[model samples]
Target: MMKQIEIRYATDADAVSLSKLIQRTILASNSKDYSHESLDLLCSIYGPEQVAERIKNEHILLCFEGVNPIGAAGLRGDYLRSVFVEPFHQGQGLGKLLVGEIEEIARQKSVSCLMVHSSITARRFYRALGFNVVKYQSSPEGPTILMSKSLS
Candidate 1:
């Protein structure tokens, strides 16, 4: 049976756990497509400092399997920023749960539009969540998809 999980609002105190989740998610999720150096660079650019800022101004959600965190997500105003699930916990509907929570946060914030710069590896997940692709391009971070969803 699948273990129970909790979806809770995250605080600055939860940043470290969230950060580790992000790193673990990246290492496992994209190991087939990303070099170790590339993944390290990506995490460093979007690590604890970025997470701290999200905790300060964004609606951060930390998904826990008991005291251990299994996934993480958040919205910066109308922008869905982070969506990560620990490798062991992927494909178990956790990613969908996190995105749903972020969408709820956006609705509560009166956001009629949602946006995200989704990584190439994550485009399908967001697409499955109803975000429509507006464009695709290369970035210093690698290829990306600029996507949006109407909440109105």
Candidate 2:
């Protein structure tokens, strides 16, 4: 039997699990491209408290395989944020599914365009999703590729 996959809007109750999932993904997948300091800083930004706050303010979605939260992504206004998938689950289409759902949400809100500050590790993935690089930017956490996709 195949595991059932479900994607749904996240709630405050999911904060702790989501935080752990994001932190784990960052350390495992993003560490290859970012410094230890950068990874630490990024992980700090996604702690349970912060994620709980974001759950209240943004459209955060969690993808579950059965009852396990395997992936997540968020949309705040026109910007896509915090897209992550479990390291062991990469290359399984979960990331693409999460982003596709985010795009549809943006379309429903009449958003003409969506933007993402892609981590160095995810730049190619974003490009493959049709986002064009707007520019490169530096932050305390590290370098990022700012990319955008038109919904129209």
Candidate 3:
């Protein structure tokens, strides 16, 4: 049977789990969309120090099935920083659910705009969700798109 999942606002205690989720998901799946060096850099950014800083400044949501973390999302003001779901758990609608959860938070906060630096793999998903590509930029890591959706 498929595991039941839940989404909840991340607390300070969740920093480690959230960091692991981001690192594990990226290492297992997103490597194809990013170079090894870039992936490594991203993983390093999830170290305890960085996670602690982000936790204090941004809103994070953690996805779990019971006590096991399956995904995570981070929002820094108007920017959607990261959205990652374990490969085994992808395509089961959790991604959309997480995005919706973020939007709900934004609505309550009265944020009228949402933006993300989208990976190649996620551009289509964001597009389908009503975000448009405002521009494409080349990064030393690879290619990325600046995407935005107006909340109004």
Candidate 4:
């Protein structure tokens, strides 16, 4: 039998689990492309408190397999942020599903474009979803690819 899955807006109560999920995904998937210090810095920025603040300020979505949070993504204005999936669940199209949902939400809000600060690990994935590179940038968290997609 297929497992049940749900995607919905996240609540403040989900902060801890979301934080853990994001941090774990970063360490597992982004470690090869980012420095250890960068990973640590990114992880620190996603601690439970920060995640809670984001949930309150951004349109954050979480995907659950049964009751376990398996994926997450955030939409702040026209910007996409903090997209992550559980390492074991990667490559299974959950990321695409999350982004599609975000796009739909953006459309409902009259947003014509979506932008993402894509990590090196996620550049290809964003490109596959029709986001074109705007430029490359460096930050304390590490190198980032600025990408955008037209909703038009």
Candidate 5:
């Protein structure tokens, strides 16, 4: 049988682990969509300090299997700020689970729509999840896809 994945809000103490997860996920999964310098920039932005601040400022959720986190996501207002599932943990619906959980939270708050600035690597994933691309922008980390899903 497959292990169960639990979802929960992130706490301050999870900053280091979460940051590491993000870094590893980005490096492993996004290298195809981003250059080395872009990956480095992403790693720097999602480091421990930033993770801690996000934990304090955003609604961040973690997916765990037997006390080990395999995925994480962040929401600020109606925007999905960041989402990452560990490399080994990908392709198991963890990313979809995270998005669903956050969308439910937004619905509870009466949010009319959900938005995300998706990494190029994740654009197809978001599109598969019912988000439409609004535009594209060049960033230090390569191209960013702006997407939105209506909750209504």
Candidate 6:
């Protein structure tokens, strides 16, 4: 039997779990492409409190497999603030699922375009999802690729 997957709007109660999920996903999946200093900065950006706040103020979503969170994504205004999947869940299409959902949410909000500052490890993934590179940018976490997709 296959496990059922569910995606839903994240709540403040999900902050700790989501934070841990994001941190684990970054450390496990992006470590090869990002330096330790960059990883530390990325991990610090989504601490539990910060995640809770984002969930409250932004449209953040989480994906669950049998009551355990396996992936998450956040949208702030027209921008894709974050996307992460558990290392074990990578390549299972969960990332695509989250992105699809985010696009739908943006559509509902009448957002014409959605943007993302994708980590180098995820640039190809976003590109495969129809996002085009806008530019290369630097963040405190280090270099990032700016990508966007039109919702119209």
Clashes of each: 0, 0, 0, 0, 0, 0
Q: What's the distance in Å from true for residue 67, model 2?
A: 1.9
lDDT of 3 by residue, 8-54 (tens): 87777877877888788878877888989988887898876788788
lDDT digits (tens) for residues 1-152 of candidate 1: 67788888888888787887888888878766667777888788668887777789877788889897888788887788878888988888999988887888788889998999888788888989999999987766667789999988
Shift of residue 144 alpha carbon in model 6, Å: 0.6
**Model 2 C-alpha RMSD to native:** 1.0
Order by lDDT, highest first: 4, 2, 5, 6, 3, 1
* lDDT for each residue of candidate 6 in 1-152, tens digit (9 for 90 to 100): 33889889999889999999999988998999999999999889889998888898888889998877899888999899769999988888989989999999899999999999998999999999999999999978989999999999
Error of 6 at 105 (Å): 1.1
Quote the lDDT for 11 in model 6.
Answer: 92
Q: Model 5 clash pairs?
A: none
Pick the winner on lDDT between candidates 4 and 5.
4
lDDT per residue for candidate 4 within 1-152, as digits (tens), equals 33778989999889999999999999999999999999999999999999999999999999999877999999999999989999999888999999999999999999999999999999999999999999999999999999999999
Q: Kindly indicate the candidate among 3 and 6 with the higher TM-score.
A: 6
Off by over 4 Å in 5: none
Which tens-of-lDDT digit does each residue in 32-62 have in candidate 2?
A: 9999999999999999999999999999989
Please tell me which model should have the higher TM-score, number 5 or number 6. 5
The better-scoring model by lDDT among 4 and 6 is 4
- Judge candidate 1 at residue 51 and give its lDDT: 76
Model 3 misplaced stretches (Cα beyond 4 Å)? none
